[model samples]
Target: MTVLVVAAIAYLTLALILVYAIDNLVALFFPDAHSAMPLNFPTLEKMMAASRKYYRK
Candidate 1:
């Protein structure tokens, strides 16, 4: 049971990392495509901009 739980957690973590990597790659290579979408995940640049704005306040 414990081993199964550990495996599940690791799988989920890897999946999330993969998704984040793909999201960034798309944003990097296809900026116009990503911008045209109505709903999209925040990329690292967006997150960093938000963080900077927050810290400036």
Candidate 2:
């Protein structure tokens, strides 16, 4: 039925919006929201390589 189709579409749209909002919120608050493993990130050397100095002054 037309009503069922419309309801399904609305449900899908709402679900997509919810997923996107949650993803953005976590990415904004958490430093590494996408990665699942530790030590997968860059080390201090890599940070220095990227010109990001962490001087302990």
Candidate 3:
């Protein structure tokens, strides 16, 4: 049981690290692309940006 728990945690940690690295690499190569956001929410970044702009108070 302990071994299985440790293995699961290790697997998840490695997967998260891989995802973070891939995301960084994609951003580095495709600065203009929106691969991080889904197509249905095309303007998600813009909307978040606008919200942050207005919430600066």
Residue pairs in candidate 1 whose N, alpha carbon or C atoms collide under 3 angstroms: none
Give the C-alpha lDDT of model 2. Answer: 0.79
Q: Please, what is the TM-score per model? A: 0.55, 0.54, 0.55
Instruction: Please rank every candidate by lDDT, starting with the best.
Output: 3, 1, 2
- RMSD values for the candidates in order, in angstroms, are 12.1, 11.2, 10.8
Candidate 2, residue 2: CA error in Å?
0.3
How would you encode candidate 2's per-residue C-alpha lDDT over 1-57 as one tens digit per residue? 999999999999999999999999988888675555455357655766666444643
lDDT score at residue 35, model 1, on the 0-100 scale: 46
| Prediction 1 TM-score vs. true | 0.55
Better of 2 and 3 by TM-score: 3
- Please write out the lDDT profile of model 1 over residues 10-52, one tens digit for every residue: 9999999999999999989878744444544666668789999
Cα lDDT tens digits, model 3, 1-57, are 999999999999999999999999998987975466564565877888899999995
In model 2, the number of clashes is 0
Looking at model 2, residue 19 earns an lDDT score of 100
